[model samples]
Target: MASSSDPKLPPLMKAQFLEAFNKPYVLRSVPLPTVTDPHDMLIKVDAASYCHTDAVLAAGQMRPNPPSFPHIGCHEFAGTVVALPEISTSPFQVGDRVGVPGRAFHPCGTCFECASSPTAEDADADPPGYSVYCPRSQNNGIDAPGGFREYAAVDSRQVAPIPENLSAVDTAVLMCAGVTVYAALKRCRLKPGQRVGIMGCGGGLGHLGLQFAVQMGLEVWGVDNADAPLRLAGEVASGARVIDARNVDATEVVARLGREDGKQDRGDMGLDAVIILPESQDAFDYGVSLLRNHGKCIVVSFPERGFHVSARDVVFRDISIIGSLVGSNKLLRETLQFAAQNNVRAVIRTFPLSRLNDLVAEYHKGRGGKLVIDMALSDGS
Candidate 1:
């Protein structure tokens, strides 16, 4: 508990706790987290966005290494720094606004991966976008107390300062969904004017991916089954070609969009890359089918069941299928900066923390846009 000297700090805080697997979350009062490690900071969370990963975790889907019981289960969040270690190397100060991604794994700085990767300008951190892959990474809300509570203790290396223009809600979404799509797009390495299709474009990550693809100068196609998602994608992304995956044959569409003879002269014919953002196996197959020879397909979603890919397609088409996790701290920072600069914002609906169960139910049903929990609100509100 923070001392009385800090009026804003509360001795006890409310948090949603998971007692065990396949159990409902228990919301109750708990002691606020304190800064123990030299590089740790105590953050007063402003907003925490719900993700499908959290839902999956709640269902006991991530077996073998699921979060230990009695844990908080949100990864994407943003807040203000309330306390910092007395002797710390972090540039952030108390009261600094910051956003945290799901897994902010700190690089050991001496590991093979870190040593081999390009060094940051500061020389202390790993190269941008590599820290998330560090072997000794710590995931918030899973490996430790998360932002579902009012105060969270986070490693400074995993926290990025939020731009002044972005609201807390938008920053929260960007922490997970934004950096994810941004990292996936970076993996594609598409040249300007290349065509890119985003599967599940109407959902949270999908919509953000579409905007990122557009901002990166790619001719974008938004693929989804729901009309609302398609309409929202068009509204926010602008100029994106919306396709109803339920009605259209994705393979045929790709064939018509790409050059049949392998001639490169056709303008934007055939997708240079397709980013599969949905959990549907059919969507994954369709994404692979839509790519031109030598094109790339980036898989960003995780379905409960494993999906099979044809080995023959990879061997013959020379198409690359890459799996992308959440972006590194460097990429997260870049995503925030890019979104702020480009006026790319997440469309979100805010709910009070008290309604967490209701929100989770809604999320399970699947909805358009992102769902964010506002910690400032009370249960009655």
Candidate 2:
């Protein structure tokens, strides 16, 4: 914890990152983020999450603006606000525990898109339709130093105050992965008694999606490759169903869901929507096959390889494919509330921020649930 009066704090803070793609994230010293504007605040990072996107950044692909040699990248983190601007309308006060979604530090609210349903619409809208095709993407990792450090600077609009009682590790994933899924589900226009299928439900974001879908009055069917992730997904989303992605036939599984299954008593075409979060193109292909007519597939992953869909299949099925980003500040707040209310959270393996490089390698193994970097560790653990 840091005090607002600590003007003598270190000029630089410890961070971890790879100098380039296909390298390791190692500890290095970087300038502590400073608050230069009234809407800006400095946070003492308590915990942060490592998503698949972080892995891609480490691997040197899909980074919008690759940081120069020795970059720090971590987009999702929970912390305490230690500094505040002189004049602000944000509900947050200094000392408030909060989470910063490692996108941009702040958003420009004056953009035409941001003005209309700012929380639901893209803020990068320019010239209407022209901007729709190429939404203005904010630069966080490339343009600004991201989390993965002891402290971060965030714009008030990009910050969400988290419940003090929630575990920082669990809430950390919510900052990015959790909020992304929640936002995608909202876009699905889900209804009570609707059947929802989540591909890659064992994943960090997928697992949270399953939990959210179940709590939101949908019957969830989680599909994943591993037995452990499948079992864990079921545990996280009580009464939600699971399918073995590697072995199960997509059409057969959809058929089973349509018919009453003894285990969950779910029947088929019963599905109203589906969300896909996978790094592989095959998952996208399979997700389309499982949807019922008029079902929506909300995609929230950036695959290393591009996805190719058959025009005939899409046209005939009346299925819709949509993409979503991390989420708006309003959605982030809703994520916190949903998690607090339903006890939905990430199953995290904690590591001291000091051991970030080594942990990045470990996370690459893909055996853990979620890995959280605890920046507040004593002596860097």
Candidate 3:
């Protein structure tokens, strides 16, 4: 990986960005991050996805800037481990292809959460929400550079091996969206043959949820307002009952597709749960309305602050609504395996890494599906 100028080390990698906290990202020559720790490996990024959270970070909502001067934009990506400065450990090797989840960089082997419970946490334990933490909340972004760059240094523990058959673009989207929907589905306690409805079924998260639900043996009902998304939902999750949210009342639509008689006992045939993946308040409200007597409404989207839900209806129906963050390593690993085996992939548009500026602008134009950055485009493309 050495360039012509330096024989011992590679030329400084370039990162693209403008001034922090309100400027567009631009690529400039920068050093390729090194593996200073024995447990770290240097990976050449193959692909990365542009997430809504990336937009938030770019817009100055999360952290104004990473600890470093220039910032790279990418959190979810799949790449090959190009260098391992220490002994080979865990499941990864020198050239193993792996996908990086957002939380991978946060875990310190000595963390209280990881030390206390590897499998399950105490119900009362108040664990640090993010694995990557700082004494000041703002110091948190320094651990791992985002996935948009040509190379990234990541902890071996956070890496998940991807199947050779799966493309990096597919793995990149699954790192976040797939893990999110998987976490939400677990909260629903999906049972074999149970019915679950997913709102916003054609977007990044919703589409994956539909496939996961179908593979788990649940009857999936996908709800979306637009015809194109609904059509995509049908194509991705065959046999799923795709409903047009605008054409009919969701409650009525769910009722019609429910049981044989369109009615069931208090426990028999209403929706077991609803997974709301869209940021719309309407989706949240509709999710509650379409629930069965004791159904759970799981909120996976981060809506703007000051949003409200109806307290009275929730109390009367015994329906529980809970919010979920991305997921833990355990759940993320399971999601990767499931996605690898079941062929779940993000529908994506690829752009060369150098064209990131154009890509970001197009992303704002409401591109359908996920947008992936092809880091390998510098050489391979």
Candidate 4:
């Protein structure tokens, strides 16, 4: 472990800040955040990944109340610990490579939601108390400053140690996209040989979900409009089925593969679960139709517009619609460990911090895989 005195800490640093909603982020110098809380650790950010949530927040889509102006926006990132609070009891040490997840708020340990087991089967029995997904909690990159800056003062609970083999870029993706899908799968509780379909398998989160399902021994099926991502999925995940959502109906394709009809001669039965990674209402509606009795449809995407589902279909078909947030701290650690052990990697495109505006433009136009900001290389603007 390296001492805090070993690294020279700077008083000022460059960051991308949102001065107002629907406005371009201004890259400027700002005072570095200090560790005020006992559990706070100051991190020197190396890489940060862009998420759809960041784009949504930038567009001023947050309803009722929005995060105050001049907010830094990026929740998924990895860095080296530069300093720790004097009273800190966190396992992390200075100079330790760590990945920071979006959940920056500390759980109110007294609530039932915090005390109960996260893996419990009964959803209603133990609701989330002060977890990051809780309505009252302050969210990183939304309600609070985030990793878009050169340095961040993060809660120790939200930080996970990065494995030796994984690079900062890889750890950044795993912080958000990786753990999200991992927790969603855990919620599905699908057994081995059970069929699972990824609605947007070619997407950043979808591709990772496909890989996880395959690793868990579930018969995986990927639905996407593009050929490139599907081909990549085929190459990486063996015995995975890919369907083109552009021509053929996604629901129909899944049904045909799963043999949803009472025809024993065709193939397997209906899918046990379908993880919806796209924010499209069509995808959500179609995903429900592809499920077997008591099957689940895990929704992981955030569509700006509201989604509609048939209440009659849900009740009659005995289908469950589960909404998954980012993930818990325990799940985040497990996700990193799983990726390290299985050699699962996120496909990423790196951009210098100077090109952040251009990167945001490209994100609006739609891009495959995750887009990362490398803080090391700057244009010296």
Best model number under lDDT: 1
Candidate 4 contains a number of clashing pairs equal to 0
Most accurate candidate by TM-score: 1
> Clashes per prediction?
2, 6, 7, 0
Q: Is candidate 2 or candidate 4 better by TM-score?
A: 4
Model 4 clash pairs are none
Estimate the TM-score for candidate 2.
Answer: 0.87
Task: Write down the lDDT of every candidate, Cα atoms only.
Answer: 0.80, 0.73, 0.72, 0.78
Which digits, one per residue and each the tens of the lDDT, describe model 1 over residues 1-381? 332225577779889998887777889998877675677788889999988778778888875468887899889999998887666667888879999887754546566665565544333234643466556766787666677888888878778899999989999999888898888888787788888889989899988988888888888988888877877887887868888888888766765665454554433346888998888888888877777778888998878776788887689777788888877677889999999998888788888887888888877766678999987777776
lDDT string, candidate 2, 110-163, tens digits: 455544542335442222221111235354454456778888777666677788
TM-score of decoy 3: 0.86
Error of 4 at 69 (Å): 0.7
Structural similarity to truth (TM-score) of each candidate = 0.91, 0.87, 0.86, 0.90
Better of 2 and 4 by lDDT: 4
State how far residue 327 of model 3 sits from its true place (Å). 2.7
Q: Candidate 1's C-alpha lDDT? A: 0.80
Where model 2 places Cα greater than 4 Å from the true spot, the runs are 1-8, 85-90, 117-139, 261-270, 378-381
Q: Could you give the candidate ranking by lDDT, starting with the highest?
A: 1, 4, 2, 3
Candidate 4 lDDT over 1-381, as tens digits, reads 222333477668899988987888899997778775777788899999998888788888876547898889888899998888777867888889999988846556555555565454544222344365444556667788888889888878778899999999989988888998888888788899888888888777877888888888898988877777666566666668877777878546655765545555322346789998888987887777667677888888867676787887588777888898877777888899989988888778888887888778877755467888988766752
